[model samples]
Target: MIAFASFAQPPQDAIFPRHHPDVVDDMDVDLGEDDFERGYQRLTCPGEPITSSQAFMRGHGTYVDNEEVIASVAGTIERVNKLVTVRAVRSRYNPEVGDLVVGRITEVQPRRWKVDANSRQDAVLMLSSVNLPGGVQRRKLESDELQMRTFFEDGDLLVAEVQAFFADGAMSLHTRSLRYGKLRNGQLVTVPPALIRRLKSHFISLPCGVDLILGLNGYIWVSKHMSQSQQEGDAFDGEAVYSNRNDEIDGATRIAISRVSNIIRVFGAHFIPLTDTLLLEAYEWAVEQEGDVRDLLQEDVGDALVATVTAHN
Candidate 1:
């Protein structure tokens, strides 16, 4: 195993990260001439050794020469990535032009909802950003109060993608389509937003046969099925977990639910993002304490979410 060393600026630790202040989104602070020492940025680039002068996104993995961290925020290095990548989770960097994410609702205003988009300022969800379907005219009316239509009150959990950065460092979001509606019937969890990928907007699948659509701007929708054609896809021969044990039906159901939620919770958004070994390790670790999967994704995890889900269910 290679013992990768990570060097970074002190200010790089505050962006997008839940910890630290002064680290706003998309904002990059520079490193002075003596900011870094002589020759510590080893070459993970095959031949050229690169020393980390400023580090951001400290815990999540780092992408090599990829320019993702070009705008480093600040932080202490925790785990260095393998060659092309390093762990930079605790760092706070802003949402760029095209970054996808999963977030939790922290505050809801008169006509908007504020989300903790894994950033310093909570992302905004304007009434117009939401696409309310099945309205009287087969679409949402313009006069509808966005705040009431989506009902994304405080404490709700959502999955969203980043569209563009606001001049005030705020990111915008949308959820006006079927794929991005209110979540129901399953569980919701949060992870380091940096790990979320942008493929198809979302990819969360739970044990209850639910498919998820995560918005890059911080809106998330989850349901039992993706569509009519996929309805039968969840067909289980009495055991969704595929267990062949002779345990009681209820016991088996409980086990299956736990397994399903954990798998999606930890690996839902990562598609070719994390190493297979790391994913397996994560799954194993989650299983170790897996008892009631619902317990893991309850009000304890998202208080406002439980209320929203309960109201819908």
Candidate 2:
């Protein structure tokens, strides 16, 4: 057995030097004045103390603890008056009053239909809220309840606005206006809800003969182009508005619709915000490609398309 020599230990002061508490805290939490001025800056995280509770009140996505305003979710900080809120970068749809949404009927109940609007709970669409086929002022009879499926059945998609809320916090939707009704002559495309920015008009008509409905819930409807006048004209034809039948879509219109849908898919993939001008620019560039609608899905083509659109934006 080999014998080991004993050595004196170094002084604790020299071996482990003490650091100032302020220095350590400063090193742990970096708060710079320039952090706020940066464009679209999101420099916050969950459980991170933002400021003293006495100075700022906690708001959504944040909580108060030990006289400190701390975030409850990872997101950027927002300030309104004395209230501080952290808006999560990615979250489920939080419906607000009068917000338009596109949803699919999940269940057909006695007088209300359960709709999936990408929310935590299924939304409620009552029979009384919908415009009957015969006319807008038509009364709902027990016979109407029997034929509720005729107006809205399971798996049928429609667009409507958030009218009210149920006792349990579920959304109540309404389709009293002609603009809100059964969806046809188009296909649904879903994206991250954050990408669908609030615009003056969610109903967009592309010059390529396609109509796009940008739902706040991120469900986009791409269909054959229709003018507002045409939409108004069809409002009287309740059969057409509520009809499950799709209007005749010509071959050219079909290709245009497919191309527009593909462009949107590409934009969503790249995490780009959808806007009327951006879409118009993208569509114009896509048409210039002289390629088939399916070509946009190719890796090189998709990347190039995104690059082109983003460059212009």
Candidate 3:
């Protein structure tokens, strides 16, 4: 009774273990040989240790704890030089300067309009940043302020660029260029911001007479393709840039737009990053299947579409 039984304590390593030794310190972890050959990105979850903090700098979606860089979100791990960051699997748009975005006007202010660009806060599009109806180089005047709605009213959709940022981190948008202006004759498709890949041109024309504006903000514009002349602002009056009327789209073009839009939705559901090449291939594959446009949304069809498109890649 006087002698008490003593219990051995667990080893220090067992009490507070580090990440698995197999987890590489670099951006990529070696999955098995097969996966490694595929060049699969390293995926991480919250609280998972990425690497020793002393060996690397932490970036967004990651935090340092106990001298180790840990993922603060579930995403793909990326490394740039000595900095490590996790790109979230799904998240709202994070605006950057010079990015092309599709947004809806939420509120019209005195000299600026608040745009919902799928960001943390509404983006601002100033009156001075837009091309006047009369001329691109025309200076902003008092009349433009009173007729702001004529340019962009509440809930009107537009395509613009990220010009700058405010002290509060809100984005400032500009539609000064001919390519950027009111969106018309199109339907909008929304997907996870992470799925839209950056390319030389976000505007894509499919072979099926469909045009796509793959906004970096995750708002896509799918519409009937316009000819080179129509796309160039010089072909018509500058007022055409802000025209709200839809150009009479034919039945065939409407069907094409619907098919492409559905294909994109399917891909988004499967969490596939979209590219122009992939969209073209997927469109062809969908047509070859001879299924109705709505059929693409069927789980089985969607899976097959994704599988087929990915196999080619």
Task: Please tell me which predicted candidate would have the highest TM-score against the true structure.
Answer: 2
TM per candidate comes to 0.47, 0.86, 0.83
* Residue-by-residue lDDT tens digits, candidate 3, 16-75: 768898986564542222442354688988988888788788999999889888899998
Write candidate 2's Cα lDDT for 1-313 as tens digits. Answer: 5763222233579987788766753423333444445646555788788777887778999888888878888988877667778899888888989888999999998889999999879999999999877456867889989989888889999999999997888999999987888999998998878889887888888888999999999889999998898887787876777788888999999999898888888877777889988888888988898999999877678888877877875
Best by the lDDT measure: 3
- Per-residue alpha-carbon lDDT of model 1 for 131-172, expressed as tens digits? 443322334344566435245556655555566678998888
- At residue 112, give the lDDT of candidate 3: 95
* Candidate 1, position 79, lDDT: 29
Over the full model, what C-alpha lDDT does candidate 3 score relative to the true structure? 0.86
Comparison by lDDT, 1 against 3, better one: 3
Q: Which candidate order results from sorting by TM-score in descending order?
A: 2, 3, 1
Candidate 3 residue pairs that clash: none
Worst 10 residues of 1 by lDDT: 235-244
lDDT of each: 0.45, 0.84, 0.86
Report how far off residue 214 is in candidate 2 (Å).
0.6
Error of 1 at 140 (Å): 7.2
Q: Hey, what RMSD does candidate 2 come out at?
A: 11.5
Per-candidate clash tally: 50, 0, 0
